[model samples]
Target: MTYLDKFPTATLLVIALTLGLAPFVPEPHIWEKIKMLLAGTLARPVDIFDLLFHGFPWILLALKLTRQATRPN
Candidate 1:
């Protein structure tokens, strides 16, 4: 079967939680935070792309779980 055939709700929920929490979590490294700020200021498009790609894996995982949960006996 496909990825969706595998943890649907949990996968979706975890991803949702992480994404929601990301903004609130302060960067531990000063340099990393600076880089993130600069990237947001300069390469805005890249940041959007990064967000999309980052969610992909989670979506796939969710789909897999949905598939598995619905799998036939």
Candidate 2:
């Protein structure tokens, strides 16, 4: 998305590392959410929001990287 383009790669990386993978103790929150997701236990609204919240940065970063790579030089 163009919104992602507004943020520099460094910015997105920082957000991804921080917000995307927060609560690092006892493993990251995202990791737990992922496990819950796979186990079909992520039915709660809060859990869904948590997954989306922690996963946004990584998704944006991936989209940005994919776009950059596919762009014609």
lDDT of 2: 0.93
Q: For model 1, state the Cα shift of residue 20 in Å.
A: 12
Return the top candidate by TM-score: 2
The numbered model that scores best in lDDT is 2
lDDT of 2 by residue, 1-73 (tens): 7776687999899999999989999899999999999999999999999999999999999999998899789
List TM-scores for all candidates, in order: 0.42, 0.93
In model 2, the runs with Cα more than 4 Å from the true position are none
RMSD of each: 7.7, 1.1
TM-score of model number 1: 0.42
Model 1 lDDT on a 0 to 1 scale: 0.55
User: Can you tell me which runs of candidate 1 are displaced by over 4 Å?
Assistant: 1-43
